[model samples]
Target: MDDEARRDHRTVGDVDLTTWRTRAGRASASAWVRLGDRFGALPLLLVTLLIGIAIAAVCTWVASEVYDAVREADDVAVLDRPVLDFAMSLRTPGLDTVVTWWTNVAGTVGMPIVAVGFLVGFTIQRRAWTPLVLLVAASAGSLLMTVAGKDLIGRARPPLADAVPPYERSPSFPSGHTLNATVIVGTIVYLLLLRQSRRATRVWTVVLGSVFVVSVGLSRVFLGHHWLTDVLAAWALGLAWLALVITAHRLYLTALRRDGASDIHRPS
Candidate 1:
């Protein structure tokens, strides 16, 4: 046999089912599609990845510019006083008392709870450790990014109309509430989508997750802990990260399907 053929044969060493399953799941998505579908799906995946990347880049740039412009203003009065006034009004012990509770409690504890929930669900259903690994990776990555963002941007929070303590000394360019909301809520939503097959479950999960994210962002502003731009930037960053992760995850799943491990797609 030729040298290339010999090398190929050598690479075909025996592999355990578990190892093979992992190898397939971790295979390059574009390559898998090319091998499986005569390069047709490869082009589509590449195009989709490019489009996603472009959109994320545009959104990130826009968010940065918007936050910078907003931060340049020396006085709050420069913007319509009503905008700030409206946000201030929501801080009263009504209109959204639940929001206050959720925001305060969630910003403190909800993330851990959600993380545990995802872990339990994954263990019970798939019995695979990969989902847990992904969750931990997402959490660590987001936390580091948030700290780095705060340090780099260093935008100040708005002056409180009422007494609202700053729990953390950090920049206000990207709201931590928004960032955490994005990661916690977004991760939960992603995991739920992967696990649940019912259309209603998917719809409701999107609605609930969207509401949670938006509310947390607005709460940060209303509580006088962050500027509107901060929350907006958080959303931009969160969405960008979520898109990247999901796209990568999809590629991984596709590779798994290519292997004999067809059971990977059995309704989560």
Candidate 2:
């Protein structure tokens, strides 16, 4: 063929160049889409898991350091004692009442009710079993971790004289109330934000959850029931666990979507 005719035909060596390029581009796009559909959540899950592990390690280190200090009667423990004494010194009837109220609300009794209510409500509203399972697992796991950590560390609580009413005898390296509250409130906020689309609503949900978690942690110290480090460790540990739960749930949803499950709701 002449040069002009060859150009018009858009062919190279008897192969249609335009057609080949178009097909190649389409194939590349299709492969990318398929890859994304299959494994797009993998990177996020991996990154989250890594971060969770790092945070958990830091918490463990902190708890261990505190445990060592207490065991050896080190300076850390000496300083910690003054903080507890100060916390006790600030106590008044009204302040005690308010702190106790928060402690009660976020403590064993009130937290269980809140968790169960959320579990039942989410299960009923979403008509899904996975959420219920996820929440129950999170709560149970938190309880297990709290108990295990306390038993393992075996750190003593503040002196009875330093504490307010409603004293606890459990070992208190990491505050159970703080850890449990973090997980419970964090999970609830995660689930709520997942279903909510509005930015304002999500922001409010996060804010409220943060306040609840922080208040619960501070109440433990304010009541002289735990040292400041105990609450800090709980925050880190609870956050790590919370991150794993959230990552797992998102992964499950991603798998469901890939498997052609039409009823699965994507997180917002």
Candidate 3:
């Protein structure tokens, strides 16, 4: 036998290490794919459920902390002073106009229009039911969570005297604009990433997604509509929800692949 072949066949205590390792790696990958096909959703469901619980825990902690500080009249620099100062520091005619414009664009009326336009466009292009269902369900769930959070907390908005024009009356624990924008923009970005195989396109899509979410959240604070904690909590909650949506969709794709279904065609 040739030296190379003999070396490949050489056994270490009756086991060929190279061949064993090769088989082991392939077996592992195949098992993973099979698991994804047969039970792909269970893991995602469990992880998402845990994340939802963590989100709830975090929100509860923030609400409790804020409540304590208010009741005790303690000045907590971390929670209160820094963000307020930052907001106040940015006050100016030109920047105020710009930020206000952003808030309006990312707010209730504008974001919905953007989200619906993408939904319709993607649905028409892909001709798939999965994306439609995923978007609708995620949007509805986000709305419900936002409303419930505001109502439950019932925290007052920043003092009217300190706030900018066109003040909001809703609770300020979680920013609805932040939460909605995160879910909508995040999901759209995910869909876009799935459609594109190019590295540059994926990178840009992620960057744009981050910019959209961050901008909306910051605008809420800049306009004095939400506290920093409010925006932070909204981000955490929104991310948790986004993870769930992405996981569910991946599970669907895995199942489709397992069943020998044709892959969903993406526009180049």
Candidate 4:
């Protein structure tokens, strides 16, 4: 009935907490050693940091350009109303109902549930933490950007008169639904690809994931819940964050080499 006894009770991958911790500790130590031995920690870190900064800057610039275009009603903003109008023209009561249902999968309440489902399923299946760690990093950054962009830009949604009901109150420069869908779904797809072997299956998985992400973005414009520019910015921002997450994870894998983290992360 002490700390040692408590570790005996807890478990992961059929190993008790104590054993799991020891294995994880060893894997981590070995990974760092491999990293330092191969490239030296400082140099690798500097290289990764520079790449990350470049990716972030590009994404930020793209989003900001879209935001300005929308604000000034020129450039890409020129297409905003016409696209919305085309979407509106196609809107039937039946179509509206279906699109609304589809869009909600990426909405505030629904997206969290979707993320939790993936996290829980991955943990239970693999008994590993790598996917959750990477996915959470990707999502947390995207969520922060969504909130920050909304607040800073304070962009308005398309006129309520044009939108479907159950209206959202948040500022709408970057569509939260589109951004979350891009990052969360994208990361899931990427993690799955890491362990996937069948070429046919991998192709299908990527195709379906890409289609779903695009559909979610389109649904926002169709529902008049977000402008075309909002979805565009979200895509740019989400891709930016997702790229950073994947690059960082790849760097970790490079450091870990094939011995410890590679197999640990790719747990079958």
lDDT ranking, high to low: 4, 2, 3, 1
State how far residue 211 of model 1 sits from its true place (Å). Answer: 0.9
Q: Global lDDT for candidate 4?
A: 0.72
Q: What is every candidate's alpha-carbon RMSD to the true fold?
A: 10.8, 14.5, 11.8, 9.4
TM-score of each candidate structure, all chains considered together:
0.68, 0.72, 0.71, 0.75
Error of 3 at 101 (Å): 0.9
Off by over 4 Å in 2: 1-75, 259-268
Query: Against the hidden true structure, what lDDT does model 2 obtain?
Result: 0.69
Q: Give lDDT tens digits, candidate 1, residues 52-88.
A: 5455445555666665665577443355245556776
lDDT of 2 by residue, 165-229 (tens): 88899898789899889988898887777666577887788999999999899899999899887
- Angstrom error at residue 194, model 4: 1.3
Candidate number with the higher lDDT (2 or 3): 2
Q: Please report how far candidate 2 places residue 144 from its true position, in Å.
A: 1.3
Ranking 1 against 3 by TM-score, winner = 3
lDDT of each: 0.60, 0.69, 0.67, 0.72
Looking at model 4, residue 144 earns an lDDT score of 72
- Most accurate candidate by lDDT: 4
Which residue pairs show backbone clashes in model 4?
none
Give one digit per residue, the lDDT tens place, for model 3 in 1-268.
2231221212223322222134454353344446655665345334444555455445545655665566466543367557877788879989888888888877889988988999998878776555666677668657766876787677677777777888899787678899889888888887777667577877888998899899999888887888777788789888878876765554334332432222222111
